[model samples]
Target: MRILVVEDNLTLASGIERLLKQSGYAVDCVHDGLSAEAVVSTEAFDVVILDLNLPELDGLSVLRSIRDRKLDSAVLILTAKDAPADRIRGLDLGADDYLTKPFDVGELEARVRALIRRKSGARSPLVSFGALTFDLNARTLTSEQGIVDVPARELSVLELLFSRSGKVVHKHVIIESLSAFDDDLTPNAVEQYVSRLRRKLIPYDVTINTARGIGYYLSKASA
Candidate 1:
């Protein structure tokens, strides 16, 4: 999963970034609302952890901007306001979920996982493609033969491909999902990851079909 952490407090933002990264998410942190708005507009993020008391634009304005532009990324409001009215306001303005400050880390992680599942229309935690089974909760992949110890990047690419199985996923989407602002991810890098996954999935009757110059799709060979 990809996450954007927008918090003005350097300590809190760094802690959130580390926590999300430890939970196997590609994360980018912005200390101000304007930066967060600009990045969220251009880049694709699965979820945004937005703080209300931002430096430039404030969190409500930022959320409004995201909704106005029709960005589909899930927004979770993280603020110190624990009042009922504050929560209602955030939700009314298009926030998917709300977490009061000084929250539990485990709860935050669970919320993020839930949001990703809901956004992807994933009912169960396990995802199946051909003879391969991916345990979303455990973040593990297995085939009829045995386990597949795919690398982190390859695993992320496979997850995205599996989520949109049978569709041609554009390279740009994968790049954004896999890379953060500081990460050196490029088109060639995405190709390399897909190429590696293509060879790995062949054993499970799965195929990564290239759509010429367009992108790639996941297909199961007819038995």
Candidate 2:
């Protein structure tokens, strides 16, 4: 999954970025609200971790702009304001979830996962195909034999494919989801990750089928 963190505090932003990255998410961050607004307008993110007290634009305005554009990314409001009125205003403005600051990082991660599940219409964290099962919460893929050890990048690619399951995910979309503003991943790199995943999946009767020039999708091996 991809997430955008909009927090002016350099320390907090860096901490959140590192935590999410460790959790197998592609995360991009911006300190000011203007940059946050601009980033949201251009790129697609699975979730936005937005702080209300921001420089230049402020969080509510950023949230409003996001809603105005009708972007589908889940917006999670993270702020120090614990006022009931503040919470109501954010929700009324289309925020999907709210997390008060001085909160547990674990809870924040859980909320993000919940939002992703809600958006994808997935009731369970485990998504399976053939003999392979992907645990979203654990960020691991397991086969009939045992839990498969996958490199982070390849695991990310696998996550994208599983999220879409049967749909043909275009190459550019994979590129976007795998990359942040500073990290650039090429189409060839995507192929390499997919290639590695294919090898691992063969034993489980699962395949990552290429869509010719486009991208890939997950399918069960034919009997």
TM-score of 1: 0.92
Worst window of 10 by summed lDDT in candidate 2: 157-166
Q: Give all candidates' CA lDDT scores.
A: 0.88, 0.91
Q: For model 1, how does the per-residue alpha-carbon lDDT over 1-223 read when each residue is reduced to its tens digit?
A: 7899999999999999998887678999999989998998888899999999999889999999999999999999999999999999999999999999899998998888878878887888788889998877667889877789899889888887777766888887888888888898899998898888888877788878888888888888664
Q: How many backbone clashes does every candidate have?
A: 0, 0
| Weakest lDDT window of 10 consecutive positions for candidate 1 | 158-167
Q: Which residue pairs of candidate 1 clash?
A: none
TM-score of every prediction relative to native: 0.92, 0.96
What residue runs in model 1 are displaced by over 4 Å at the alpha carbon?
144-146
Indicate which candidate wins on TM-score: 2
**1-223 in candidate 2: lDDT tens per residue?**
7899999999999999999999989999999999999999999998999999999999999999999999999999999999999999999999999999898999999999889888877779999989888887778899878899999999988877886788898999888888898887898899899888889888888888888998899988764
lDDT over C-alpha atoms for residue 8 of model 1 = 95
* lDDT of predicted model 2: 0.91
